[model samples]
Target: METGKRVPVKAALKSHCWIDANDYQSLYQQSLQDSVGFWRSQAQRIDWLREPQKIRDTRFHPDDVHIRWFYDGELNASSNCIDRHLAGNGDAVA
Candidate 1:
């Protein structure tokens, strides 16, 4: 059986960590309460070719259902996923 448990964050990695428990809850609430603002804030984390002027374009209805996010923005998957984070330490062991 697998035991579900949480581990304490060590000080050294805390600075590089993205969000702590409390911040995660706040982010989740922001996503629900203020979706567009949340998305706009998150979009800043990645490198964009053309920054998005509009946050979202979505319609949820039985007759017409459509959803488009960051339609105007452009980003490379490899850059966003791997290259951006490797800026300073390219030769370091993983």
Candidate 2:
């Protein structure tokens, strides 16, 4: 409920969560060490209309700043987020 507060992941997530607490730290370090390779693997987990040719185009300079990730990839975000869930969740609203 409070901004900037860290939530206890074990209490918030099911026991079956893909990444456990230790995994979080390891993954964070991996991302820092090899951002492109790390993100490339993560991107494959999603459905893409067309896979990305370029992974990122980020600029952090004060005057010119922008971040673009998977900009070349194409997919309907709505289908992935909402419509795709209906088949499994529609009849199991409990």
Candidate 3:
């Protein structure tokens, strides 16, 4: 008799095509060390209508709660998701 249930591995679940298995440790370490810099680099991959001047902003109080990312950035969601891809993958099915 065999049980079909299986536990997922963390590495397998977090895999990325852009990152190599061997480089994962180093990249993880770098991210931990410089999260802001890492995220700034990652943000460059996206198309921003207006680039952010600040990475994050946070203010917490009993009356007011504010948390923001890319505070100065502006972007069109539809353009980023569909319009950008139309040129390369328009005919190809999603």
RMSD of every prediction: 3.7, 3.3, 5.7
Residues 1-94, model 3: lDDT tens digits: 3598765557766674566656888878878999778778878988999987788777799798998888788988898888998988989988
**What ranking emerges by lDDT with the best candidate at the front?**
1, 2, 3
- Clash-forming residue pairs, model 2: none
Between candidates 2 and 3, name the one with more favorable lDDT.
Answer: 2
Q: Lowest-lDDT window of 10 residues in candidate 2?
A: 7-16
Clash pairs for candidate 1: none
Model 1 residue runs over 4 Å out of place are 1-17
> What value does the lDDT take at residue 68 in candidate 1?
90
**TM values, all candidates:** 0.71, 0.73, 0.68
Better of 1 and 3 by lDDT: 1
- Taking the tens digit of each residue's C-alpha lDDT, what string does model 1 give over 1-94? 3578767789998989888889999999999999999999999988998999788999999999999999988889898888977878787897
Selected candidate, larger lDDT, 1 vs 2? 1
Model 3 spans > 4 angstroms off: 1-16, 59-65
Ranking under TM-score, best-scoring first? Answer: 2, 1, 3
